[model samples]
Structures are given as structure tokens and as C-alpha cells.
Target: MTTRRFFIKTTSLASAALFVKPGALHFKDAHIGLQLYTVRNAMGKDPAGTLAKVASIGYNSVEGATYTGTENFYGLDAKSFAALLKQNGLIMPSSHYRLGEDQENGKDLMGTILHDWDKAVDDAKTAGIKYMVCAWLSPAERGNADHYKLLAERLNKAGETCAKAGIQLCYHNHDFEFTQDNGQLPYDILLSHADKNLVKFELDLYWVNKAGHDPVALFNANPGRFPLWHVKDMDNTPQHAFTEVGNGVIDFKTIFKGADKAGLKYFFVEQDITPGDPFISITKSIDYIKKNLI
Candidate 1:
């Protein structure tokens, strides 16, 4: 993933705009954020500038993808980063982390097994992040439900420690979790086994749709469990193809209708690839969400 490409997908959208009644939309105190992974290059090249662009687009918060291989994020430690965010009229509330394992291959990747649970807690505390998430699980860990159960237990432990620091631990999902095993989805197992108070969910809209399911249905089934959401759009042609937020088939208005039931606190815009300029797509998506869903 090149730096700019990492900012998001290559999918394209027509330059059209919608005019929604402001008062008709349900606006929450929780402001929309961006997943920095979408603009990894921008962040790498100029963290401050990238963050400034994000805030300029009207997003008030962000979820970090990485910590720049240092305890600091983009050369700024927790305190400095917080100051930068405040200066830019933004907030850094959460981050996605490689949890429990260094690599998905089950090998001791990243030169370690991520053995420093205490250090991990301390680092996140220093960063002032309220949530530390195990971003994704590899196929190797998806061998069966038992593995998920074990992972859930481990996540609970991590979440418990985070709780002591006044932070929440969460899990982000891709399409794989919805894969059926013994007629049951692994997501169900993870959700059922994990401690609710300690751990929560960050639902990715594109992945949920790719899994041949309804995001709203999941929200309805387990109200108040999903506190975060990755708001991305799917191309009208197929599952994997990406598109700008409102240009695709995802009915975000309908999803937002369930926001209260879903216990949504933060929503972030993300794209793995783009058909055109990432800036255009990002700005368009933000406009769509602000105009329609809020």
C-alpha cells in the first residue's frame, strides 16, 4: 500500500450533491472521524497536514491505524498529539492495534509475541486513546469456533486491563467473521463469549455487506453492543468493489435509524482503495453523511 493509496480505495464517484433538510436529520453529539489507514501515506509524510485535511473536511475525530512503529504517533507522543488535535479542532479517541499476536501466521512476528501487555496498556494510556482494538484476525485463527472462544477469552483479559485505565478494548471485523462454521457465524461466537462491559464491536459496513448479511440486522440483534462503525460504501456491481459513501447501495440513513439501538458513539470513514482521487471520495462521503445521516 503506497502512502496515498493507503489513505483509501481507488473507487470513483460522480460529482453530485444532495440537499437534505438539516433539522430533519438526527445529529448526535458524537462527531464523525476518519480511519488514518485510508490516508497512511499522507499521515506518514506529514501527520499534521493530513490531520489538518481530515479536520478541514468537517470530521472532528479520528481512529489511528498504526503508531508509526514508535510509542509515539507520527513523532508526536500522546501529549503532543493531543495538543495537535486540540489545536486543529479535532480529537483522537481510538486506535486499531495488532493484538495478542504479532503476525496472523501464528509466528512471533514484529520481533516479538506482543508479550508486553503492561507496556501496551501504558503506551495506550500515554496516547490518551480511550479504545484499543484488535483490528483483525487472520484465517489461521479462524480454524474453528473453539479458537474464537479462546481468542474471546484472551480479548476479555486485555479488555479487563484496559478497563482499569478507563479505556475500552474493542474488535474490528472483516468479511471472514460471518463465515459459517457448523451453521454458526464466528462473529456470534466472539460476541457471545466476550465480556460485554470490557469489550465492544467496531462494525465495518463494507465487510458486513460483503459477508452477505445486513448490518442493520446485526445492530438489531445485539443492540448497544456496537459502539463504533466503519462507514464505507460498496460498488453497485459486486461485493469487493469500493465506491464513495452515498453513491453505492448501502442505506446509511436506515442504518443511522438504528444508531440509538446500536449504541453508536463514533463513526469513521474508510476506503481500502479508490477509483479516483481519495480526497474527492472522502469529501463526498463526508458531505453525504452530514447531509443525510448526521
Candidate 2:
């Protein structure tokens, strides 16, 4: 029901890459998600309109990116946001969260893992989310090998909280996580120290590849450790930038063949930056995904 006739009139209505051969695969819902940050600007302006457009573009699910500062999903409360999603025939299965830094004043910020963690989890439950990811570590936040060990502990604790809420907790990686410090990779340290039963990894395919590692080999190394993914593609340029799914160099078909091996439960199409109309780029990605990479 990805009809193109609702944005201008409905309240809830509002509103990538690559080349290569078109393959055959059915578009599957829930299995695929669009990380909302790809359209962060538009979302800031009109969450409902953007959601309608997202559904029209054929994405039935999304992973949230906003909640911390505003303590809402694009400025709407959890109940209101969830209703808007349902109105647009979309579901949000996961959301990213920040691990807030401590303040000299002794009061931590609201809407972060270290502060009002329970409230966030409660809101997530109301919004029908099943996974919560520790989004990123700021430059100052990630210092040395010991930093990762502490992070692992935090992730395990956070995972325990999420578990009680019936939600899985995951850590999203950036290329920085792979950089070796004193010959020990932070990513490796994290994977080793974090409680396996409690915390899982949300592998960012682009970043991992950017760090010069083989994802399949990583999957083989830690089977069933990855349940979520950010499926943004890397362009075939010298810069190796972001592009639409099939247009890039990533062999998604072969990568997807290892879905079961990686315990990949969900993945989202994400492009940090787009060259032209973001809508058109996403449409191109959706069309490609329809043909290949189910």
C-alpha cells in the first residue's frame, strides 16, 4: 500500500545508491528498516510528513535516531509517535541511545542511559521497539583500552535493563572502534568483555569495511553475535563514500547469504549524506532492494 497520495492532506502523512544488475528478491517488511537519521533534517521539520513519505517509498519499518535532547521522537511523545507510525503503516523496532557524560555539577542529563534509563526503556516499550542500540562514543568518551572495558561493563548493565523490558541491547560500531591501541583493538576488547548473553553488536557494515576488516570473517569469528546492522553502502570512489545499495562495491548478495550465520535479525538502508534529492536516492535504493538483497 505504498500509494503516493496522502502527504498534503493527512496529519500522519508527510512525507541512496548504486549500479549493477537487478536481481530478483521480494521486498520484506520488518526484516528491513530505514534508519531515521538519513532524513534527520526533514524529520526535524515534519516527522509525520516524512513518515508518510517513507512509507510511500516502501519502507515498512524504521530505526529511530532522536529521543535524547528532545526526549521525544521528532518532537512527538511516544504514544503520539507510535500512532503516527501505525497511521503510515510503519513500525519502529529499534532506537539509538546515548551514554551521557557526567557533569561537574553532579547531575547527569535526562534522556540518556546513565540518567533516566528506566524512562527511556518505558517509552521504548510503549513505542513497540524490540532493540535499543548504544549509538556512538564521542572523541573524549573513547580514550584508551580501559575505556572500552568500562564501556563493555556499561553495555552489559544497559543490556540487563533492556532485557527486563523485553528489549535486546546492541552496540553500534564506528571505524574508530577498530583502531588498535597498544596492539589491542577496541572492538575486540568490547566483544570479548561484554556479556554475550546480555549484549549483542549492531555491526555497521560500512564502518567495519572502512576499518579494513572482512565482515564475513568477523561473523565466522563470533557466530550469532550480531543481530542488527546498518546497511549503508560504500561507493567505489577514492573517498569510498556513501551510496545507494547496489551502486556501491559491497557484495550484499553474498553478505546476505551469511545472514543466518551472523544472526542478523534486522538491517536498515542508511546514507549519511546524499548528493541530490534524498527521496529519490531512497527510492532508488528501495527499487534496488526490491530486485536484489531481500
Candidate 3:
């Protein structure tokens, strides 16, 4: 009896070789990738199967999250995982990682820096990922500007390590990064002080808007520093609900036009919460991007 993994491996090769007739499909001038976290339900069930579904949805790449679990990315290890992605016409360009944990306790905080993320960086290299990012800053770490300065120093160290490995260290933002400390935004401070060669940024459009800022303006201010982005949408309603792409208030066309200047190399569609089926939500997002942004 053929095992599930064997069956998947065979089918993946066949899928990669499938042909596209003339004018059958078109990709964006800028490629569009998916963040697997968008379909967390599917991923939690079968990671390889979930990857297959993403490929079926026309995604040529993916961004990973929570890499510590899920049979170490379908039990293939880093090199095998990279091979699997290549077999599926997919590339994993980046991954989200939690910031360092406290040494005194196991919880993540600003109190300590990650001494062992070098191992993770090595694994990322094997998986063909170019960017290692801190996905979120803990509340304690975000408590003040000095805290952010400290975080920036730690990130600089990580970024330097990644630079030596031919990779980049990036910081992903949420709405709180816009919170002011002594009339200065912590995120701005981070951008200003962090080593430019070592540190890059992954701008989340939705959270930037939620923080009452403009994505295009940010791109204009810092040209070519951002190489990754989180593409999510928000409802036009008074409550500003999370909704499917193209059904929300964000103006992606304007943003997509400025991608080159923004230093955007890859972008992933993400939604923190879905009002309905996540699969449907992701499908709609893919369709919207292909139709409008592509």
C-alpha cells in the first residue's frame, strides 16, 4: 500500500508539470503569495495537504508561521520541505518567529535576547527562506520607548547574524507599534536606530491603517526598506470589521502601484479572523488580487 506521503510526492510532481495553454492564466507583474495562517484550520489538520490546496489556489509561494510544531513541516525536515515546495511550484520566502523568551522564566519578554535563534536561522536557510522575522512584540516589550530601543538593539544583533547567513532579519508590526511614547512612535524609533543593513520590516497594511496611518505615505518616507508585507482588509462599516479582500476599505491598487518603491519583494494575504469559512475567504482574496492587483 502506498503511504500518504508517497502519494502526495507523486501527485506534487505531476501537478508541477501540468501545462497552461496560451492565455490560460496570467500572473501579476508582482507575484502574489499566501500566508498559510490564513487557512489555519486546514493547516492544523494536514500540513502537506494544506500546501497542496494552496498550490491548487494558484499560489506560487507561501509565508510560514509557528514553525515549532506540525511534525516539523510534514516530517520532511528543512531540506525536504524546500524540495516539496519546489516540487509544487512553490517557494517559501519568509517565516514569522516569536521574539526572544525571558531567561528567568520561559515566557517571551524584553528581559532577554534569543541566544539560540541561530539554530532556527540555520534551519531557515535549509528551507530556502531569506527573511527571519519577529511576528509580534509582547505587551511588556511594548510598554515604553526605552523598551522598544532595547528591542531594537536585540533585533540589530539578530539582523547582523542573518546578514552573515545571506538572510535578513525583519520586524512585523501590529497596531500597537504606533502608540506614542513621549510624542514619538516606537516603530519610528525602531526604524531610525536599528542597523539599516541588518534590519528590514514587514509592513502590515491593515494594522497600519488601524493605527491611523497611510501605507503609501510610509513607503514614501522610507523608500526600499520594506521587503515583505501583510495584505489584509477591513470592513467599511462603523465597527471596521475584518472582511474578505476587495470587500473592504483598503485601497490596494494605490498601494500595489507603489510596491517597487516600497521595496516589497513578497506579500501574503492574511486575516486575523474570518467572519465565515476561511477557505472561502482565502479563495476570494486570491481572486481579488488576480483580478485587480495583478
Candidate closest to the true structure, highest lDDT: 2
Model 3: per-residue Cα lDDT over 1-294, one tens digit each? 976435434543343321222322222223457887888778767777888888887677789875642225545678888888887778888988777543225633331237466677888899999988888766655778888888889899888888888999899999999988899998899999898778989999999988899998988999877889999999988988777789899988888777767887778898878988887888899888766664
**How does residue 155 of candidate 3 score in lDDT?**
92
Instruction: For each candidate in turn, give its C-alpha RMSD to the true structure in angstroms.
Output: 8.0, 6.0, 7.3
In the range 1-294, model 2's lDDT, one tens digit per residue, is 533223212322221112223331222232447999999899989988999999888887899998875678888899999999899888898999888864424756577778788999999999999998889887868989998899899889988999999999889999999999999999999999999889999999999988899888888999989888898889989999999888899877877767767887778888989998888888888778655664
Top candidate, metric TM-score: 2
TM-score, per-candidate, Cα-based: 0.85, 0.88, 0.85
Whose TM-score is higher: candidate 1's or candidate 3's? 1
Ranking by lDDT: 2, 3, 1
Model 1, span 58-154: residue lDDT tens = 6778887765235566677777887887778776678876654534346443311155666666667876788887887655556788878888898
**TM-score of model 1 relative to the true fold?**
0.85
lDDT of 3 at 125: 91
Clash number for each model: 11, 9, 0
Query: Lowest lDDT 10-mer window, candidate 2?
Result: 11-20
